[model samples]
Target: MSLEFELCLRRPFTLLAHEALLNIYYSASCLKKKAGEFLRPFGLTDVQFNLMMLLKYQSEQDEGLSQARLSSMMLVNRANITSLIDRMEKADLAIRTPAPADRRSNIVKLTGRGKELLAQIEPLYTKEVKRIMAALKLNEQKTVIEMLERIRGNVSEINENTTQDVSLVRA
Candidate 1:
């Protein structure tokens, strides 16, 4: 369905650029909602699933990841990551231990239960993702990926420009 129709807009968008941005936002929100519903039965949130996947696929063998590292990788604040880890700990899905090199920083690792749950969920998750993306052909999907990358680059550039403008104003 067209974004305008889906949004029930009485009139056309004022700007094509704004329309495109809203389309992206709406699509992302819808996807997140669906994913949350899909994951809820498994007793996991989307963020937790993402964190578990990272730990499963990216962590060094038996070494785990530091909380700071997880925060940066997850694009979240340290406090948020800490809270997430705390919840996961309570659920026995993950554990935090003192980092070997830096006792002050905790290393987060998936527990055995966590690994087992992920192993069970990953295949179903992959299938759901495939079903979602199957609407777009492989080439179309590739193009979408490229376009989104460009959008991200543009956003970064704009952010830098805005920061510089703010600093100049202050100066």
Candidate 2:
């Protein structure tokens, strides 16, 4: 059954745009739910895993990311980052060290354990994404990506006057 069929709407949508919007929203909700379930076995939430991924890349430079920078990168506020960093530090997945030059600031770094977790889960995550995209042909995937970018641009343009870029939207 198609997404529309699965949705069991009271009546057919009058506009293609309306149906398409609902389809995208439903698809994203379904994908996020499945992904969350998949991550459960690994003891990492999606956000924590994303944070680890950021640290993994940054660690290559031998420089830790400051807490403020990480907050921006994660698109999380300071309060949430404090709790997230606390949990990750407790799990030994990451470490926060005081920046030498700035006593009040801390830098976040992935520990050996964090790298190991990413190594273990990366392949499965890759396979899962490939599996999901396999529902569409290569060209269809590319077309969808282009269409989504345009839709995103249209949406972002409306909020240009806001101080924050809409692109930094949290998951």
Candidate 3:
């Protein structure tokens, strides 16, 4: 049977619920695309911007981070992280060096240029974030974040269960 038929047969409610979830995903994707366009002139993708922020945050603690750890923290594949790091390196925004403690892994360090870019972008990013959040009251924004976190937790649990079931079937 087709996937839709299977979904409907297994749990019609789930199928209906997924429509709303899909709509949220699509809408978020569109918004991200627009935000990416805005950031393009700054020579940053959303992910790259996020990485720069992460690095800046860590710098405050006097801690350096590894690319592999960053990939895991960001929930992205290593190959993608490598490519992103490569691009950033070429732009002179960051550098990759062999970790002093681990020969196998490379640490990603933000350069002076990266810090400068982050400083330049912070105000604009903050303004955009505030403008986006302005649609909701302060309390509403908190509630929305809580609700999304709950949804994410639920989805993660379901994924884990599904993976276990598939493994059982294979066994």
Best lDDT goes to which candidate?
A: 1
**lDDT score of model 2?**
0.88
Ten residues in sequence with the least summed lDDT for candidate 3: 1-10
State the lDDT of candidate 3 residue by residue for 1-171, as single tens digits: 343463464644356667668656765886799789879999799999989888878654636589888898778999999999999999999999998888999988888898899899999999998987798999999998898999999999999999999999999
RMSD of 2: 5.3
Measured with C-alpha atoms, the lDDT of residue 162 in candidate 2 is 53
| Strongest candidate by TM-score | 1
Which pairs of residues collide in candidate 3?
A: none
lDDT per residue for candidate 1 within 1-171, as digits (tens), equals: 989999899999999999999999999999999989999999999999999999988898957899999999999998999999999999999999998898999999999999999999999999999999999999999999999999999999999999999999999
Off by over 4 Å in 3: 1-16, 59-62
For candidate 2, lDDT tens digit of each residue in 45-153? 9899889888877655748789998899988999999999999999999899999999799999988898889999999999998998998999999999999999999
RMSD of each: 0.9, 5.3, 6.2
- Model with the higher lDDT, candidate 1 or 2: 1
lDDT of 3: 0.85
